[model samples]
Every structure is written in C-alpha cells, then in structure tokens.
Target: MTTLVRGRGWARTHPLAVDAVLASAVLVCMVVGSFAEPNGEHGPTWGTRTPDAPSLVLMTLGALALVFRRRAPWSVLAATCAASIVELLTGQPRAPVVMCAVIALFTVAARTDRSTTWRIGLVTMTGLTGVAMLSGGPLPWYAQENLGIFAWTGMAAAAGDAVRSRRAFVDAIRERAERAERTREEEARRRVAEERLRIARDLHDVVAHHIALVNVQAGVAAHVMDKRPDQAKEALSHVRDASRSALNELRATVGLLRQTGDPEAPTEPAPGLHRLDELVDTFRNAGLPVEVALGQVGLDLAAAVDLAAFRIIQEALTNVQKHAGPAAKAEVSVVRVGPNVEVTVIDDGPGDDKGDEQRDVEQHTGGGHGLIGMRERVTALGGSCSAGPRYGGGFRVHAILPVTTAKGGTA
Candidate 1:
C-alpha cells in the first residue's frame, strides 16, 4: 500500500511521464493483439499472423498520438481515429490500431463536458464503423470488427464520464468539510473573547468599588490621627471592613475560574440586588449620604439581570463617593414598569469638574471603567444605557433593563 501511494504521488507530480507510460502500455497491447486471429481455427488463435508493413505503421502512429492525449485530447483523438480508418480501408490484413483510439476517446470524454463527449464519441464510433464496413474486404459489411469498434468506443466514453463525475463529487465533499472546520474554529474564538471580556469586567467592578472606599477611609484616618484618636480608630475600622469586603468579593470573582476539585472554593452565590442595603451602608460609612429607592420589589429577576442591577448601583455610588466632592449626595432608584426595569443614579455634586463629561469608552483618568462597564453590561442584556452631565449640574446615569432579556428569559 505504501509503495502504491508513493507511485501515485510520483504520477501526479509527473503527469506527462504517466501519459507516456500509458501510451507504451497501449502500444504493447495493440502489438500483442495483432498477432492473434479471433476467427481462425479454434475460437481464437495467438501467434498465427503477423501485421503487414502499412498496418504496423498505422498502429505505431495511433499509439504515438496518445502520448499527447492529456495535453490535446481532441487533437489526439482525431489523429488516432484517422489512423484506424486508414488501417481499416487500405491494409490487406488489419491490425488493432483502434485500441489507441479507444484510450484517446476515454481521455477526451474525461476532460471535456458531457455534451461534447457524447457528440465527439458518436462521431468517432459511427465514423470508424462506417469506414470499416465500406472497405469491401472478403468479410461482409457487418463484421465482428465493425461491431467491436462501436462497442469499445461507446464503453470508453461511458467509463470516462463515470470517472469524471466521481472526482467532482469527492472534491465538492472535501471543500465542504474544510469550510465547516473553519467555521467551527471561528465560533470557538468568538466565544473565548466574550468570556475573557466578562471576567475582566467582573474583576474591574469588584476591585474598583471597594478600593475606592478603602482609599477614602485610609485618608480620613491619616488626617485625624494626631488630634482625634477615637475618630482615627473608627476610620481605621472602616478601612479594615472595606479591605475584608474587597477580599471576599475578589475571592468570589476569582473562584469562578477554579476547577471543580480545587480546594477552598467559595460555595456562596454571586451578589445581586438583594444586597442593595449593604451596598448603601458601606458608602454611608464612608461619609457619602446615598439614598436608595427600590420600586422593583417582588420582581423575580433573572440571575444575570439582578447581578447587573447590583453592580450598576454599586459602581455609580462608588463614583459619587470618589469623584464627587466630600459633601455630595447620591440618589439610586430602580423602578420596573411595562416589561422594563429602569435604574437611575443621580448625584447633586459636580462630577469630576473638567473631566470626561460625555462618558464614552474612557470614563476617567484613574484607570477606572466607570460608565464603560455599566454600558457593556446593560447592552449585553439587550438594554439601553445612558450617562451624561445633567442639564443644570452633576452627573446622571440611567439604564432601562428589559424584564425579558435577549436570551428569551425574564430578569
């Protein structure tokens, strides 16, 4: 099998040489057939006759024409057919020169279209049989030789057409398999990119919010450490609480990536709107008065929608506490009406005076993904989000999350 594979590879690389080999094979078969007389004594007799000079020349000429069959199938077929006609008409004892024409006809049929093959094959078969019948030898018009020519030529055309059809079918199947493989690879890459973006958003939301609180409390402790020990100790305690909360959230976020059998994996469910009061108390402890209005009560929101609502509120209040001046107040409201839940956060404080007002991709300069993360989360759920400076003053973020998400589930 390996040797056959190697020979096939060589034949493909040297197609002209393969054609030459086929021509040689056809020549040998014609020469051997010419020495046998089928109508002689017993049914068929070998080595009973030798081809005459003209018959030998016609046979050689027809075989040589096949060497160029692949390059010019029609031209070679015409030459071989002409040689066969000459042997049939003039040669005293005919040689089987038509063998070369049969091979050439097969090549023509395989290379050309079916309509061309049928027309050309019919012409060759009828032309050769007519010439042999009209030759007026001792044998009658409807001899076995004439019938053999018609049958062989017809079969060659059919066989070549079959080969061509099978080759085209195999090629089409191969191309479709390759296309499907490429599509699968592209889909895998798209899913991986979406997963990476989600994990990064989670890390950013968890870290940025708690770190902002920790920064505020630590700064307060440093400011009053010398004069007010009790107040400084209280400030330090807030910092400690913020740090622990940050650790737990961080653990939760990172735990999503841990393998099932890994040790010390957190079993707690992810945070959602149920913890809105705790989120508010954290900011209030940092000296930012955040008032919450929850009109989405008793609404059985999807897990994803609930988590997004909680993060939107958390990030908005964090921005107010961090970027808005110390005396600023924030109001967070989540109201559900008519197949949608609207989350709005409005702050009376000036939002980073001389900062990013339009709230585009770059929300601020502190490496924070403030409005960017919020917009991405809302948009993924097929909802609309907007953040900009309110007409008079301050910043306002409003998002309408659909109760029924794009994935065909209610939030």
Candidate 2:
C-alpha cells in the first residue's frame, strides 16, 4: 500500500512539467511570427536586420516564468508583464510576452480571491495599451492596429479569470464529498465500540452468578462426604450441571464475534418469564424450598422488559441459594404497578439474622456483583431497583421495569 501511494503521488506531479513545456513552445512560435510581416508582404529588411536580438531575448525570459506559474502565480505574472512593457518601448511587437503574462494571470485567478485578480488584470491592460499607443513618435490618434492591441489584452485577461473560476468550483465540490465520507466512517466506529461494551457486561453477569452457585454446592459436598457419600454425589452432579449450563449461555451471548464460515448459531429460544416455573422446579429438586406467586399485570409488556424481569429474578434466587442456608425458604413475587411491572425476591435466611446484613454485605463484596448488574439493567431501561433487609427478618430485592423497552428489544 505504501509503494502504491508513492507511485500515485509521482503520477500526479508529472503533468505540471508537461504543461510548462507546452506553454514555452507556444511562446516560441509567437516570437518567430513577429520577426517579419505575418502576411509575408514585408520580409526581414537587410537594413534593419532580421528582428534584432534584444526583442527575442526579452520574449524568451517572459516565457521562462511560465515554468513556476502554478507554484508562485503572482511572481510569474509580475515578471512576464514587466518584460512585455520593456519589449513595447524598444520598438518591437510585444505580443509573445503578453501570452506568458496571460497564462500567469489565469493561475492567480484560480488560486486567489476575485478582487485581487480583477485589480491586477485591469492595471496590466491599461498600462500596456497606453505604452503601445502613446510612447512612439507622432502617429494617427485612432490607428486601427494600436486599438486592436488594447482590445486583445482586455479579452485575454477576462478569459484567464473565467478558467480560474471553473477550477475553484470543481475543487470545492470534491472537498465536500470527502468530508461526508469521513463522517460516515466515524459513526460506524462509534457503534462498534458500544456493541463491545454491552457484550462485556453480559459476559460478567452470566459468569458471576453461575460460578457462585457451583462454589456453594461444592462446599456442601465436601462437608457431607464422611457422614453420607450418596448426598455428596448428588451435590457434585448439581455442580457439573450448573457449570455446563453457564458455558452454553456464554457461548450463545458472544455469537456475534464468530468469524465468517463458522458453525451456525443455536436456534433455541432465549429463557424468559415463560420459563419461571421450570427454573423454580430446578431449585425444588435441589432440596431448596421455593414459592412463586405470579400476578396478572394488565398489559403484555415488550420482549426486552419481560427478559430483563426474568434475569433479575433468576439472579436474585441464585443469590439466595448461595448466601442463604440450605433450609431457607424464598418468596418470589411479580406484581403490576400502574404502567410498570415489579419483581420482588425475599428470603428468610441466616445471613439476615441479628442485623448482620451489613456485615455480610461487606464480607461478600468481592464475590457478589449480581446486585450491581441487576441495577444497571433496570436503570438502562428507565426503571428502578433496591436490595436490602426486609422489615422483620430477611433480605428482599425489588425491581420495577417500564412496559416498553428503551429501543424496543432485548440485548
């Protein structure tokens, strides 16, 4: 790519050198034409010598300035115009010198403001025509030949300014197109960064909850190993199931990262409120007493709201299973609160006894980020959540979610 860019830069530079050569060739032809009568009626007179060397030298210098006109337009125009004035006063037809000056004028017009071009162009034409007519010995006041020189100079200046305007207008259009393309690329990058952040949040939420459950069950198996081997085996089985389920969900959540031609994604439906009964049955089979109370909310909420509510309850219950004692009983409730739906999970566990909730929170701070994740999800959807000890003797988690999702869908 670097080599290709360097090659293209060279290609763009070569054309300017070609243009300079062509302009010099045109000036040479104009000087040669002035040596004798263009109609061939008065060939070079032997007495006067064929068009003297001084006039030819001045015209060559004026054309030489054309080489730098694109890079330094104003300097080239001043040089060429000065040379043309010298040629006119020395009794030589100065048309070739004016050709180089006209080319430089067009370059300045295209590169600078119109006011500067107009002021300089008018001054050059008026001074050149005045010298051509009034400087020589007494002649007819309205000579046709002298008037033609004045008219042609004015037309040349106007034509050069027109070319300059067209080039500038084309350049302005190209610049706007490039700016619009850059803006589109910037927007695309911003969206990709946001998607990566969401994926990280989901991964953390899934891993923290399941791993904590596995740790709790593993501890149970170790404690009962000597007293009862059969109970230890059942706890180990639960631990294995929980780990495998976590891996599957994590793989599905990060499916967007898969490269092209990878295996097809899973077509199974994501777990939502409809799976509440089944989730509760799993706890019942694991020797945890759980009661679910589902109330009839007036409206059918959007899919994102339903999914967020289900995950909130699932994480809350998972916390109860890990921190609450094996014999603890949990009450899960879902109720309608005007335009929103509310989910509450309450547990009567040892962690709540003797007002040790604050101390337990401090001790388990490193392992439990579930409450933080739950709050983020709720708040992101324009809802609210609070988790703390209940009135009498338990820990309760309450969440209220809007009926319509923020962008109208789940992540």
Candidate 3:
C-alpha cells in the first residue's frame, strides 16, 4: 500500500516522465511484433510479409501519440487511429500498430464521460474492423484478425470506463468523509464554547453574591470600630462567615471543572430555589433589610430553570446591596402564574438623580455584567427577564420561567 501510494504521488508529480515510459513500452511492443506474422506459415499470401519503411513510420507515429494521451485523450486517439488506417490501406500485414490505437481509445474512455466513451469507442471499433475485413488481404469477414481488433477495442473501452467509475466513486466517498469530519469539529467547538459560557455565569454568580455581602459587612465593621466595639466585632465575625461561604462556593464551582475521575472534589448538589432562605439570610446579615414571599408552586422544577431563577434573584439582590445604598430595603417574591413561575426582586432604595448618575457610572465601568448574565441564563432556559428602575424609586428585576410538564408532574 505504501509503495502504491508513493508510485501514484510520483506519477502525478512527473507525468511527462511516466508518459515517456509508456511510449517506450508501446514502441518496443510494436517493433517486436512487426517481424512476426499471424497464423504461422498457413496464412494466406496477401500483404507484405514484413513491415516496410512506411509501415514502420506509421507504427512509430501511432505508438508515440500515446505519450500525450492524458494531456489530450481525444487528439491522441485520433492520431493513433489515423496511422492505423494508413497502414491498413497500404496493405500492411497485421501488426502491433493497432495496439497503440487501442491504448489511445482506452485513455479517451477513462478520461471522458460514458456518453463520449460510447460514441468514440463505437466509431473506432466499427471503422478499424471494417477496414481490416475489407481493404487488406483476402481474409474473410469473420477472420480472426478483424474479430480480434473488434474485441480488443471493445474491451479497452469497457475497462477504461470501469476505471473511471471506480475513481469517481472513491472521490465522492472521500469528499463525504471530509465533510463529516469538518462538521464534527465544528460541533465540538460549539459545545466547548457553550460549556465555557455556563462556567463563566456560575463563577460570576458565586463571586458577586458572596463578595458583595463580605464587602458590606467589612464596611460595617470599619464604621463601628470606635463607637460600638461589640457591633464591630459582630460585623467582623459576619465578614469571616461570608468569606468562608464564598471560599466553599468557589471551591465547588471550580470542582465542577475538574476531571470526572478526580475524587477530591465536592459532590454536593448545586444551589437552587430550595436555598432561597439561606441566600436571603446572607444579605440580611450584611445589613440590608430583605423580605421573602413564596407563593404556591410545585417544587419539582427542572434543575436548569431552578438554578437560573436562583441566580437571577441572587444577582438582583446583590445589585440592590451595591447600588441602593446602606438605607435600602429589598423585597423578593416567587409566585406561580398559569404555566410559569415568576420571580421578582424590588428595592425601595434611593433612586434619586444622584443615585442614577452613580449607577450609570458603575454600569459604564463594567458593573452590569451581572444583569447580562442573568438574562442569558433565563433566555437559554426558554424564560424571560426584565430589569430597570421602578416608577417612583429604586430598581426591580422580574423573571418568568416556563414549567414544563414531565412524567409525574410539572418540572
């Protein structure tokens, strides 16, 4: 197989040399056959026993025409056929000159479509056979020479057509395999990108939610250090708790990216709507007044929708704590309306002109990626989220997630 591949590569790179070798082989065959006659001594006495100078010249021209067979198949066939016809008309005995025409005919069939092969093959077969049977010696119409020419030319055409068909089949299979490979590569890339985006969203939610609480508590500890030492110590303790929780959550999030075979990572389930109370308490301890209201809704929500809802609420309250000032109060509500579950987080903070300006500056400096991440998560799960300033004051974030019906109940 290796040798065959190398030979094909060499032939493609040095086509003229390959053609020269073929021309040499054909010249040798014709030269050797010129000295021999058909039917031994029992043949009818007709044309010259040996090839004359003209016959030799015709034979050489026909054989040499094959060197350009691949470059111009039809032209090569025409030249070889013309030389053979001249030999036939001049009463030359059966010789290997016809072999060159047969080779040329095969090249034409191999290179061209089946329709062209049929037309040219038929013309060459009929013309050469007719000439051999009628113009030459006193051989009969059914003579072996004429029949042999007919059979050889027909076989050449059929063989060449077969080669052409096989080549086309191989080429088509190769093309389809390449296309499939390319499609698989593109699909793999798309999956990797989606996985990276999901990890990014998870990291953002973990860091923003926990770090925001830590920041607020640390500020409280600093503000009360002189006047109220007891409250300052309490605040510092809350900051420690918040930081520990953040580290744990960050570890869990990072663990998700580890190899499946690794045994050191945590196996805890991801945070979802069930963790709403814990999430609310974290912000409450950070000194932001938070109220939670849960409506009648099934607990069997799909994991993805539940996680998205939880993250959206988490991010909204984080934004409130950051932008709504220390005097802000936040309200969170989860309710079921028809086939969807709605989550709303609203802050009754100062949304005055000065607050709006600061918020705008924060947003411009890349503080708004939390909202964008929330929207992306909701949209991915066939849900919708909207966030903006409220009518009178403060900001509100609302999201609705579809409850898909499952085998046992709605999910």
Candidate 3, residues 4-119, lDDT tens digits: the string is: 99999999999988988998898888877777677667764434367778888888888788888999988899899988887777845656688999999999899889999999
- lDDT (C-alpha) at residue 95 in model 3: 66
Name model 1 segments beyond 4 Å from true.
259-264, 297-299, 356-368
Model 3 bad stretches (over 4 Å): 1-5, 40-48, 260-263, 352-367, 405-410
TM-score of 1: 0.89
lDDT of 2 by residue, 136-207 (tens): 444453454456556666666677677768878788889888888898898899888767755765776567
Q: For each candidate, what TM-score against the reference?
A: 0.89, 0.73, 0.88
Residue 82, candidate 1: Cα error in Å is 3.2
Model 2: which ten-residue window has the lowest total lDDT?
Answer: 38-47
Per-residue lDDT of 247 in model 3: 89
**Model 1, poorest ten-residue lDDT window?**
357-366
Model 3 gets an lDDT of 0.85
Q: List the residue pairs that clash in candidate 2.
A: none
Candidate 1's C-alpha lDDT?
0.85
